[model samples]
Target: MWIHKSRNPNQNFKRGGCMFSIFLWEEKDVQRGLFKMTCFSAVEPKQLGVILKDMQRIKDGYAWFLDGCVFCIQPFQNQSRYSLKGYRIFFNTSIETGMYLYDITLGLLGGQISGIECVIKCPSKKSSDWISGLRSDTSFQMTDPRGLFNKNGCGIIVVNDTVILQMRNRNKLKVYEALKKIDSIREELLSSVEYDLFSCSKEAG
Candidate 1:
């Protein structure tokens, strides 16, 4: 079980009559780290080919579109083994690419999409530390990943190698703001932990 410190309730924001919420997940035992963001969207399974074709048409020589992303439809159980579920359009490699996909996805689908789920992976640090650090630093409620999504449509999850930050809100600005907040928290954690480690080494020397 994960125990978390509470984040300020006032941190939840709403603007232009749209629903906006954010959450951070916390675990009991963990280490510290840095983060890079990746993103994906859930869409109608049938729209997979259409969206892929459109993206290809406007790829504009951006090789990353082909090399750094994935497009696939999910398989579901329906009476047979081949029933298709929804599609997952994923983007990795860089924040710029993820944001670009977010922009065009909105343009193409409008409010039809809930929002993109951004995964912040910390390759050089322990996910447990990141979760613990976020739990202490942010006012976002500490909840299980499922609760985070069921309640606010936005939340964080710590997997084996990464911390996934998911937001389902359709407002682009709010989504960006939430990502920035997470980034800020990550930087603070890195700085504080690094300073502590350095001081410990000096003392040992």
Candidate 2:
């Protein structure tokens, strides 16, 4: 489970606001890593709602939540990139807590709620590249090849195929609970894996 805390929540965090902005990638490698980062800035809440309503008219594409200040690092490689790869649209929702902080991803498809899944790369020492253990009852996809590492030593590659988030938030307290639940489920999956990528590497040596 990766938890990101914002230094200034209001400045950096914007949830479901309007003033539509589309960011295009200018740099090659930077664009490849852009999905792991959420860069949407503040906008008007009503404007955000209008955009969502318009989106519902579209028959295709995926919908998901993008919690500010939290993200998962993961590997990306597709054998068939030009094919019918799914398109995803995400919204930001910040669930702040005093002790713990993170964001939860809620997925929707064809105007109906669907399951949530996240695949991210972590340090071999901090997490294992093996993610079959995190599989939920629902169908999911993962790809962790043999040799891959970032500049940082963190390169294990973890994923959460379980843990669905309910969009029921009456107040700040409820939001906090929802965020905590999401984080806890991630922790459970990481702990249950029981093996780190480096451990296998050490044995191979």
Q: Give the Cα lDDT of each candidate.
A: 0.40, 0.27
- The regions of model 2 sitting more than 4 angstroms off are 1-131, 135-173, 192-194
What TM-score do all the candidates reach, one by one?
0.42, 0.27
In candidate 1, what are the lDDT values of residues 97-205, reduced to their tens digit? 4455656653344423334444444435465665565566456566763213221344666565455555554335365555555545545545766776788799999
Measured with C-alpha atoms, the lDDT of residue 163 in candidate 2 is 20
List residue ranges in candidate 1 displaced over 4 A: 1-63, 66-86, 93-97, 109-111, 135-141, 144-154, 170-205
- lDDT by residue (27-135, candidate 2, tens digit) is 2211111222121112222343344442221112212212332222111122233432222222222223211211222112111112122222233322232333333
Q: Give me the candidate number with maximum lDDT.
A: 1
